[model samples]
Target: MDSIEPRNIPLTPGVYLFKDAGGHIIYVGKAKVLRKRLASYFRPDKTLTPKTRAMVRMAVSVDTLSTTSEKEALLLEASLIKKHRPRYNIVLRDDKQYILFKLTKRHEWPRLTLTRKVVRDGSAYFGPYTSAQAARDTWKAIQRVFLLRRCSDTAFRNRVRPCLYHHMGQCLGPCCLPVDNARYRAMVGKVELLLNGRSSELLELLQQQMLDASEALEFEKAAELRDQIAAIRRTVEKQAAVLGSERDMDVLGVAETSKGLALGVLFVRGGVLLDGRNFFWSGLGLEEAPEMVLSFLGQYYGPQSVVPQRIVIPWALEEQAQDGSALPVMSDSLGLSDEEVLADSDDPLAALAEALSELRGSTVRIGPPRGDAENRLVTMAQTNAAEEARTSASANVEEILAAKLGMASLPHRIEAVDVSHTGGRDTRVGVVVFEDGKPAKDQYRTYAFTDEESGGDDYGVLAAWMRRRLESGPPWPDLLLVDGGRGQLGAVMSVLEEAGCGQLFAVAAIAKARSEDSNRADRRKGGVADSIFLPGRMNPVSMRAGSPELLYLQLIRDAVHDYSLRRHRKARAGSALAGELQRIEGIGPSLAKVLWEHFSSIRDMADASEAELAALPGIGPAKARRIRSGLAAMRTKA
Candidate 1:
């Protein structure tokens, strides 16, 4: 690896990729003046941080993608970072999409539902809630207060009678009953108001409605409205009001602690603190704060992500020239004339705001806090970030694990594997991943094995899984935990050794404790603890029964075990369905696969009409009729 010559780089607004000797991108960055940014890395006098110095040492070459403008460069950088996930970049490991509340607009009987994506489907979306549970809680609260339809359009159309919700007086039975359209529409309007954070106005309307119902002697209606008002009030009371006016903005606060750098964002809608989220990165210091902040904004507020109109940060994104002193014209370094350098050197803050404004489809303001109220909000955010950092630092889970497990380094990313099968059929190997002591659900994966490959042999399944895992390649786990004792560990180790990558990752196995009387595996009975065995070890590691490290491993083990069993069951069900479909005349594996892809379950297939079946890719009218009749006969036999 050799240093990249910065002089050869073009002076343009674009993204740069620093590739290692293996041609793998280790870092991705965007720069307004590409030559100047690259020069900083190659300058002898510039003292680089340890991380940067290491990145430079590993870099053998540089790749650049020129963009038309700085804003385009910013977007391109985020896209590349997400795709490549370079080692030196501040990658956000939480890949779960934000939750949104979708309200159907075109449907005559609109229903509210939670979705992870926002599409241009003529529906009103309310939020990008960071927590699924919080979004569900809010949706449930809204349902309790409003009598809107709760079923999907398909279920609403197919319903024969009112559901249990209607019986419980929670719904107006719009699906099967003649509910007043005007009243339902009005309720929908109120729900919109509540979601938009106009609860005060909605409360007034509800109060007025209750009075009118009382004057009309509609006692039940008036009492229901009163309950609705109370519920809305209780919900609104939970939010803390921090602004004098109804302005929606997001406040960002950064905190650097011994553990890492933590960034907290508070979502303020209509002057109330709706929700807040904290992101923490280990080993990052205050010196990288500006870059971290910029990267966070670019990654967090993605294309489908919701962007607030205003964003307040603790400090400026870039240091401004003080006392009206202008920056030195980089005509020579940038290979541009003085006029061009002056014109192209737009303030990074303004460019970022412009990019966000375009994404939001409205004007967006980004800057430091101005007034006392905003200062207080920023302070609150900073306090939250500091608390999060302190909590993360106190845990020290990785340090304890490293000491107890006798590992060469701290196991930051752990992957656990478990094999499941039922009498040599539908074998499945589930892999669960944990990063930074938390479950990374998106990274969890499952592999299937043929009956011949498994043969009811756990060791054989493990070996097959290891080979497939090796093929998948890097972003390899720090430690590989298997769900068996010495035999299983050996199987995995043998595969790795045979593949000539024995030292790629550490391997360990967990075995259930045996009962003394029966000498049978005691599955968590009578306080029996599981044993963990490393490769070539005859005995288990000495970890206390309820130690955090032991509990964490147990947690990972249980997760993979459950995931494997679920996958095994699903595979069995799918196999059974395919076999049954194959038994029918004129149906083969391909048609069965098509049928399975179209229908979720056997019951769903049974309920499909002939016309519906005929609409499938290859199933013609004759095959569709045969399929319908076959399913009907199968159901009758059942």
Candidate 2:
């Protein structure tokens, strides 16, 4: 390791990286002034924490990336930390985007749908709901009240008859019915108002509309409006109101325990507690709180993330002096003029707010709690964070498994793999991930295999998956659990050994229990306990039937089993659709694929008009007529 010269570092604002002997970056930090910050790290009188001292000893060199302003440095630091995943940085591991209610208002008959990703495709996104079930419940309520279109664009364009929802009066069936544009647009406006948390205004409008309908002797319409008003009221009442005025903001709280530090965020929309999220980092202390808060804010509220009008924190957003040393006073040796030093001293908090405001396309205020209501919200957030920390400390399922199963380390990130197929057709491999004893659904993946690749065998499927997994590389699982016995475990180990990754992670397999006498799987409840097989082990590991470790593995296995089966069925259905389409005259493999891409089901294709068919690439009027006739003839025969 070599000492970094403070004189050589720039006095300008920038981000710095500390690299170890192997040239691997272990830490990343941003600074108001690079020279002062780097000097803080190397000062002899400064009292460094054990972690900081260890990092400095391991570092061989430091690299600086200069930026025009503190804001630019902040953005660059977050980006580099995310890309390189430096060891010392507080990396937010959850990459899953929040659920949003997307209203496709650009369509003639707009529909509301749930999505995890947001795009600029003329759709209005309402939420970054932490709970998917809550978003779906709201969406369902809107659909019930508004009777907006429930079908997708393709389904709406191709349908010749109304769906069951239209018959049940849950939808207007704009797909098949001649609905008035003004009426539908009015309903859409009401939905937008409701989703925007302007429920009071919407209720007033609905009440006035109901009165007008009653005055006009339109009793049915009046009754419908009355029901709609009631439903909206119920939904609003379910949300606990914490303020008199409609204010949308997020409150941050911090909790520190002997185990770790936890940060909690409470989302308040229109003065109501919408939801809350908790993040915990074991072994982190209050001393690291400033860095944690900044890093979390930068990573969590990224581009496409929802930014509220205001953000309330438990404390001031001020930088802490590193290693008990005050910021270095500007000196001639540091190579900075007075004007340059003044320019670099811009407030970090203000810069952060400006960056967030730019992302939100509006002003974003960041500060401590302003009043009693906000203080209460922050207190609640802190309570939640503390409770989360307590719960996390109590739940040591991974540690228990590591000890019981003789694993080398705690399997914090476990992935279970299962292969699904029907009689060696449409083989698919599903992978489910568990992080810290809970499902990380966003990391779950499914891989499809053809007969040529997998040879219609479980071993072949596992091998193919292993090769692909190797190519994808790192963030590799701590434990790989397969849904089979010794043979499956052997197959996975062989592939990993061949690729020189056998020791990279532990491997195991699960097998259903069989009746000892009959040698058949018992159907009765608690008839037999399942068995687990470890790599290079001759027999199953013996354990109680309902032990937590066994049950946890079973839970992961069941998830992958269900996931893989669903994917296999979906593949088969797609194959059936393609087969049916290719049966039509003047349609081949390419044309069938194109048709499938446009229409999800054969019924949609059958219901499509000749003009629609002709509009498809490689299909002109003559072929369109031929294909339409062929489909009609096939329908008649069926």
Candidate 3:
């Protein structure tokens, strides 16, 4: 069917799929009242994320699966999401870009190091500090307070005497010193507690120990303990601990944006907010906001995941009322009676809370946090999530794009270059300029990259254009944009560096993520992201889909692409015309033109006999034969 009216879908619990013209599912969603949720999409006035609007614009039909209960619908939706890996479903598995602290507990002398990935090894891992600087600050604090050994295993084994760190009082001089392993291990334990948001407990022990040392008249030991306690207290104050409970709780907050969805999860233990990690995802979809939030939590807290005592989220529980809508949608397969439904209908925390409680071997509370302290913690998480979303969703596109892509400054005067290759040949390069976020058409330029083979290497052609511009020393823009990815960016950066102007200007490269899968669903034409790649980063910097910055960058790239294509076509057309004239022995371009004017068509020329050709003013028998032969070869090749 070309269209699916909302009324045609089942009203009960189920999953829905929106398919494009090729019958490929672009978006997957679940709802308790299927028709109600999906109807919102077809309404013209309802605001939608840019990605969702794009999906709806492309959707040609809809499909659904009726589930007995909403929980079943949630389960089926999660399974389908993983199975199809739909482009619009923001399932988390690849969003882990946070810096973490890893300590190899398996090692005899473990030194904490920064890492981005957490493995299943026995070694302890803590933190997902959203940035490298944040992780570095935590490490610096530990060094200032703990004074533990800070050396690689190899260095620790090979040192002959106390190293500079030990002499500087930054390390305990474990290497080439009579150190007690028991005391070192105990100090390592304290570091572990400190890193995991259990600093209050460590502080209490430290204060007690300090008092004992003072009573024993050990003034130096007492002073050291006092310093450590102060360091821990400073860290706690900086983190903003609004709650005072020892129980571990994971406060959750999420926000949606055109760039993507951001979820901030703050780890709170021993009544202090130790650390928070923000996971970002692209594909801001049209799934029911509440159900999608539930799905995100389900995927985040897997069966094997360590469940905290509470999973605080900034969402209202819909199951609070006796006749709460969620109750009827739950399947009888779970065997819930009227009493059970009301008992947990406050279950607006959702069914996952029960599962979490079972997994944690204790009751787990999941709901909109109550009380000033708990609410404040949830608010903190929400603030982080909202800020992250703003970075992607900001209306200040140019400024936000500059910040998101890690540019040196706002790209007020920007220049972007693109390489156009047709049939993988006859390449041309174009440079498009934007002044104050608008195209500066008079400054645009195009060049033919006629290096027979260089046309295929976008990097090589971009390099050539960049090198030419650098050598000639034209007025530089605040930022330079390239139409390819990391490789082209690296080439352009190298050219600028060789010219001694690498650090003088900012540069970034944009590449559209191409699908290797030829299937229609994987074939994202206008919908695919044009990823921006910057220097010194392994991952491409992300900008929102419809962000002003992205729109500006795309506009420049498109302008350049259009300019290059025009030049390439003109060059190819000229080459074809020249090849015909160059093939004949005596007929130069002028003679060919005169002959062409006389015949008016190649067919007319081919039809004329050799004698008629010889009678023409510039055409003799020898030249006529060559022209005839060349025409014969051209037709044969065709």
Candidate with best TM-score: 1
* Candidate rank order under TM-score: 1, 2, 3
Report the lDDT tens digits of candidate 1 across residue range 287-380: 7787788788877776566778899999875521111223333334445443343343456777678888987778999989989998988888
Candidate 3 residue pairs in backbone clash: 259-544, 317-348, 319-345, 344-347
TM-score, every prediction: 0.86, 0.81, 0.49
**All-Cα superposition RMSD per candidate:** 4.2, 4.8, 22.7
Predicted candidate 3 versus true structure: per-residue lDDT over 291-311, tens digit per residue = 456767766664335557787
Candidate 1, clashing residue pairs? none
Tell me model 1's lDDT, rounded to 2 decimals. 0.80
**1-638 per-residue lDDT for model 2 (tens digits):** 45566567887889999997656678998888887666656534355555576677778999999999889998998888766656677877665688988999888778899998767677887776888888888888888999988877766777889999999999988887889989999999999888877888999999999999999999999999999999999877767878777888989999887777888998887777778888877667787787788788887887767788899988886545443333334334575444443344445578788899998779999889988999998899989999987876324677677776688756767899999987788899999988777788978899988867766789878988889988876566778999888888888999999977777778889887788899885534332498889887897888678977788888888888889889899889988867877888799989987887888766677778889999999999999999988888877777
Lowest lDDT block of 10, candidate 3: 320-329
Q: What is the C-alpha lDDT of each candidate?
A: 0.80, 0.81, 0.69
